[model samples]
Target: MRSGKQADFAYQAVYRYMIDLINEVSPDVRVKLPSLRHLAERLNVSISTVQYAYSLLEKEGRVYSVAKSGYYALPVSAPASYCTDADLLERLYAGTRRPGMQVLSADEPAQLLSLDASLLQLERELLRRHPLQLQPYSQPCGIWELRTALAARYTQSATRCWQADDVYVGADLRGVLEILIEVLGLKGAAVLVESPCDWLILRLLRDAGVRVIESPCDESGKLDLMQLEHLLRTESVHLALFSSTASLPPQERPHAARLLEQQGCWLLENDIHGELVFDPSTHFLRDLVNPGRLLVFSTFEKFIGPEAPYGYLLSRHLSAPLQRQFLLRAFRLSPIRQRAIARLYQNGRLDQHLRALRTLLKEQAILMDGYLQRYLGARLSYSMPQAGATFWLCSTQTVDMRRVFEHLLARQVVIAPGELFSVSGLYPQHLRLSHVFNGNHSLDRVMEALAEALKYGRIG
Candidate 1:
């Protein structure tokens, strides 16, 4: 009976009601939507209003129309995760295990950066007395015991109350990502990635057949959010993957996340260094977005220990049954190791370790940044190390990075070329210097080699 703009409003209200009804039904239901005439009669609205509502719901994939039959509700199901070439995965394991013979080439903390030996000894003694046993998989989402511990840690944060069902622990960042990709239907889906992103992510996207549109990063070293916004508007990217914290300048992150959400895109947050950020402004992205739309990947190795057995993934929307299936299919739980580790973290020891490490790293970053500026002069400045061990170098375009890398290698000094992280592999002039240099010896060796290399036109 409604007409004019009021009629449009009536149509929208009816459409939302129908969607709610469809969503409330069990996944087993076919949800044969009522015919337009029937719906109009039942709701006491015009056939045009019913038709418009149906059209809108169908467009959103909440329902579908058969050629001759009426529309039916679509199943609330996720997409399958598919990857190619286990060989690449085999290579990744091989590479990760070797731990870069050249000490500074890796991003992990200095071996000395761990908790003081005294604390480790104390932890070991405590574990020895407790001697735990492996138990049946606890809830498959993760061990509930660990979730309870984690929830307690974040209890004071701005986030809503977190439950055991909201957490999922996986083997590592990649494992967590794989599970998300599989359940989210990102395989063969379009994705927007930073040009010089984590190489492993690129590999994962490639294997999954996801088309990647690269965003150019600026010299201040943040991903260009404008480009990202443009792409999301024009392209069909369903996901945007980013390191929640990186050696580069803090991302124009909220804007990027907003753009993605506006375009109905999902965000995959690789918070590998999430716990390490000393700056308050560069908070974790998971803290910014709706948990249902964000999948956060975090590892404790950055703060506690690298070999820690468990990694935590936080997501709010994943159903319990899907999480259980993922746990059984992709990984087997090791309860004894997880519980033992959780005990150390729960007793305030982990907080102490993280605080101490943050202090040490912050001081080291200042020292390294100042040293790099003084020695390399105007053309070289350390990337904004908001927090984390990798010191990015914003080198002049004139520098010959290959020669500098080779010269440093000859001196037994190893650093990652900035190109290693680039999507197109086109950035040869930039470098990623490691702050994990063992005292003055390694730092001095790198400085001397770099000075000589610059003189010989080996690098600018």
Candidate 2:
């Protein structure tokens, strides 16, 4: 990378570090950010580079300057959206008038993310050494070497006591989830999911004969704890899967984890976005919760492409029966693929790519946020996520999003509609826009089409 790109990377690194620091404490407690010279020296970058980062953060309202001491982190004082679950649940699904409209499909494959050039190059080099050997069927969960690497990563800084024996691997995220559902006998179990949860997850639960209850979350993607506690107390929920994604591990995260544990509910940490956090040395929920009661599943596909075979399951309490069932049904990853991935861990390339990816994501967020503010600011409502490639949005007006989606589809603009995220199709106007803002898609064209769709979608 050239000096310009390096400077941009340095700026984002400092920006994300400040974000992590701000989120680490309660909003009420004031926290100061490192000085420009101090941060630049620590990061080994020029002081001017840090100055540019601090200025941009102030522009974005992420920090404030006192003119004397230095900058301080800004805490999230209020949620961006405040709609209640009951209110939104009362809204019907936004059915399209042109029910057969040939608009875009919400389900777009991970092209920029999936079929990336860098990841492909890395794979090609690894495959030359590891080759395409068919995996042996000895280790049902995974080979010991790969699992050991994952355990070491999970046990970063000696804060965690993860063991290779506690690790399990699967071909993909969906397959791993399927195994958990079957092994747990969740055919008719009651589960509590966050309102506006990922639509695909909701569909999977529905298919598994799971009775899911919803608790609405705010714009920051945090659910109402009182409602969650009530449901856990009354519903006897088998498991609770929700996102606690932030730049750094929020201190408040433990409260929710502890609540579920106190209720004797199994907690599944959806570490998809969690793993992609900008700060490389952030904490994880595993430190707060008992491992026996938690099952953490995450995919390596984010780092490598989607075809890069491996998703893992980590739990300290892997029973013999569950292990037996896993061996009987789970797909044993190819030996070569396991070795290649393990090599990624051993060489530290994985960590390098992660930092670069996080910086790139933050860069993408700023680009997308600028355009969204310029074009669809009034038409749509959203909060720039602290991490991840996707943006969760809700329409300002209650319109038929299904028709709006179709319109955007006709323009070759793919976006996830609100109905997919809710159990009752409550968020008729909510939608998720992904992958478009990362310089992969034409920003001007996508925004033009999106604005037009929302215009036609405005109905009482």
Candidate 3:
């Protein structure tokens, strides 16, 4: 080890040199470096003082180090400076505060602050039973038992049965889409997307270099399959993605899926809204599953709770070896969180919670419809879902969605803008109102605020 005196001298010299170099190369300004040899000789320092300063420059990434060559200045361009949206998106992810203008910008559930206690307790119990390893990565294939449990849940279908090995854990649907786009070689490839599809998916796929072909949705809320077929015949399509029957009426899904398959395109189904409870009589997925043609995506966050740690992906035709490889390389981490999720399912809490949630959502949907009809008159038109945690409200051209959003936010009311759900920025002048309020009190307040917001909305 170097003597304390030598270490101090080296540290001082290196710090000064780095500061000078940074200032000189930075576009904003310039600064001076101390005379290396002069300072070294003046202080009875060795020639190594100057050499040490130079070496530290390369070591700290301030300069480039080369074999058999001296250091050179680093190219001033940082990775963030070159990449698109890296800074803005990073800031968005880091930002925790809500927007000051209005409550509608985010997709946060209204009762999250209060009802999270139960979820927290459940998570605590899970941790108590099976400890989590925070540092190591999760099992590449996700929690095996959880996958098995999920697979079993859908086993009634003979043609589309799955095993625990099929589920892949991701942060969210965006995370899964990223991997899918990369693995499917979809960069620069044409993608057939619904015109009013989920905005997040459209934006993410576009950012991934996938060209989108937007097809209008029919009155039934299913993809206009005729337009899609024409596009497939006329232009090359790498993939066709859409939300499943949960968003659209159950009667429309199978017909749409059959039409989609005739185009010879790969299908990607995002079933994030599926967990909101389905009627036992409705055979929504009866004929929609064709493993050779479909890949399904779903999340536990909406049904289990927004903070649920896992997302599930299913592909019918993807080979086992490739699937295994994807899991091994992608996960290679711990499966504790997924296992916890499985245990929740095993304890039957998921089903019980979903039952209560559906009941609340259905009640709220009715309440929302009644309020809009009675208070707003004919100014708003809402297309009520037969099942789901949310409903959409349409507004006239005279009504500015943004202004109304601001007005409601000031009154401590939050809702989602119509543009948030639109695929190509063609908002239908609407708002997506959630009915997931955990208690009766907040739900009533939300309806009151919404009615009041609409009154002033026409002129706001």
What is the C-alpha lDDT profile of model 1 across 178-297, one tens digit per residue? 667677777678887766676656766676667777776776667666677788899987777777774233355566556766887777777777767776345555555655576666
lDDT by residue (tens digit), candidate 2, 1-460? 1143133245567767766766675644556788977987787765544655665555334565543577765354422122233432111111111133221222222333443454445445655554444324467787888899988877754545788988888655655777788877889998887677765477668878999988787766666666777888899798887664652236666777778788888877777666566565666665677667878887776556543535688877755755786676545455555666777788887777667677777777778788899989898878776766777888888788877865675665656677768778678778877642334456787788889999988896
Off by over 4 Å in 1: 1-102, 110-112, 116-141, 154-159, 246-254, 280-282, 320-325, 454-460
Model 3 lDDT, residue 383, Cα: 63
Instruction: Note the clash tally of each candidate.
Output: 2, 3, 9
Show where candidate 3 strays beyond 4 Å: 1-138, 218-225, 246-254, 278-280, 319-334, 438-460
Better of 1 and 2 by TM-score: 2
Weakest lDDT window of 10 consecutive positions for candidate 3: 89-98
Candidate 3 lDDT over 247-346, as tens digits, reads 4456656666676566677878776666654452445443474567777787666566533524567754554643655553453322434555776778
Q: What is the Cα root-mean-square deviation between model 1 and the actual structure?
A: 19.9
Q: What's the true lDDT of residue 162 in model 2? A: 84
Ordered by TM-score, highest first, the candidates read 2, 1, 3
- CA lDDT of every candidate: 0.61, 0.65, 0.56
